[model samples]
Target chain A: MSSNLILLVSLLAGLLLGFFTKPAANRARLANRLLMATILVLIFMMGARLGLMPDLGERILAYGRAAIVITISALIFSIIAVRILVWLFMRKRGGEL
Target chain B: MMLLAIISCLLLGLGAAYIGLMPPEVAVFVNEAPFYCLCAMLFIVGYGMGQDKNTLRGLFKENAFVFLVPVGTIIGTLVGGLLAGLILPLGIRESMAVAGGFGWYTYSAVYLAEMHSADLGAIAFLSNVSREMLAIILIPAVVRFFGAYPAVSICGATSMDVTLPLLAHYAGSKIGAAAFLHGAVLSFVTPLLLPLLIGF
Candidate 1:
């Protein structure tokens, strides 16, 4: 099966399971534990996979200047854009400044 | 919680690889296992969303204003990228391809490498990696100063995965769902935009 289909099926299965389960505090706690465990494993695996890639030290050193500039700029612009939207939203609501 | 775990594991794995502790066969598993793990994570995300009525309701109840997060993020990243490009020796197309990763470094870097230069690919990888690290550190500050939506938007594609749990925790399920949506949209476009923009 296709990866997309696999992703969709997994999501749908989870949704169905969640929909049917009773919303007890214990159940929520279990789910939280399960989520945390899965995330830990997933991230660990992600790190391992990333580690298999080419020399990161050289990559960082080679591209550090461009990378830093680009990343910081993208971050700044994204924040500024959201800040502007928030201001516009507040203005529409006649929020007290 | 996540920072310590993620950083430790990442360093441990890299250290292990560097020291030649792991076998070559481990490389095969490393390539495929992450994909399965990602699917499981997505499933968990779906389950959480399914259980949360408020998240579902917020997703459906949104109007045109709701689009601001995704739209603003894309415009902001591209604008920032274009401006940042002015400083680089690289062309605008190359810069966009690098920034277009939107924090999904592996896919965009590989794609760019195949379609463009190894240098551009390396730049894309480093750019996206730095973006993720910065986003993790910045999300809380963004939440405190700007608000939840802004916090989520700045992280881009990472909002769907690496940053999702944090977003859900600090920002609540409502913003988590929005961040997921925003990330999904960006993730879908990163590949398309990288090549298309570069072609121009």
Candidate 2:
């Protein structure tokens, strides 16, 4: 089948399944379980196709430097922002330090 | 349910690996990890929605402070991105800034990797994902030990998804509502601001 056709069918199926499933505990659990199962199967298939395992270590090493820089910068920025905002708010409201 | 979500994600990773063995044409959707990850996210969202109507209703209120947190976070993200761009090497700066803003490396990392190259993309992914995981684990203690505004800021871009729920669960429910609103708005704004600031 064509990509468009597949997409259309999947979309319809998803909607139909979603609509038919009542939001009760038993039904929701069943739906979640099915979805989880499908996700697992899909992931395994994708990994096999891509040969993810062998390249994993190399990918990590290659990307390590850049990742560290980004993570540290983002973390520091977030922390400072939170601190300054809290300080300003506290001062405005005359709250304790 | 949260445990179920984690298991589902793991299952998804395994499934993606299995699907990888198939011919590309035969497994279009499953071949794309991001697309499948998104599907997982959507299901998680739906499941959360299914469980609680009150979640939506509680989002709005007088004491919520919805506007304040976003304003603070966005300002923080933009300034932070600008600083990172200036100081960090040029290669992965834009992706990093964007990840910093939204706190989800997966989307930006994948996009940057595909558009630019794998090296930068992987960096973005790892960094952003780390930020998200850290926020999830730390935000509650930060809030309880410090206060709401600080927790909101500390979690920064990740406040919406990972931290918002954590805050709601641990902090007062009212604070959680405010955090959710702040986080959601920031998620949208971060992408727009990233390019302008970081030149991505």
The candidate scoring highest on DockQ is 1
TM-score of chain A of 1: 0.61
Q: Give a tens-digit lDDT track for model 1, residues B3-34.
A: 56645765776667666676889866755565
Candidate 1 wrong stretches, greater than 4 Å: A1-60, A94-97, B1-58
Task: Candidate 2: give its CA RMSD in angstroms.
Answer: 6.7
Which candidate gets the maximum lDDT versus the true structure?
1
Model 2, range B4-45, lDDT digits (tens) per residue? Answer: 453355445535554464455654554455444534534443
User: Residue A69 deviation, candidate 2, in Å?
Assistant: 3.1
Tell me the chain A TM-score of model 2.
Answer: 0.44
Q: lDDT per model, in order? A: 0.70, 0.54
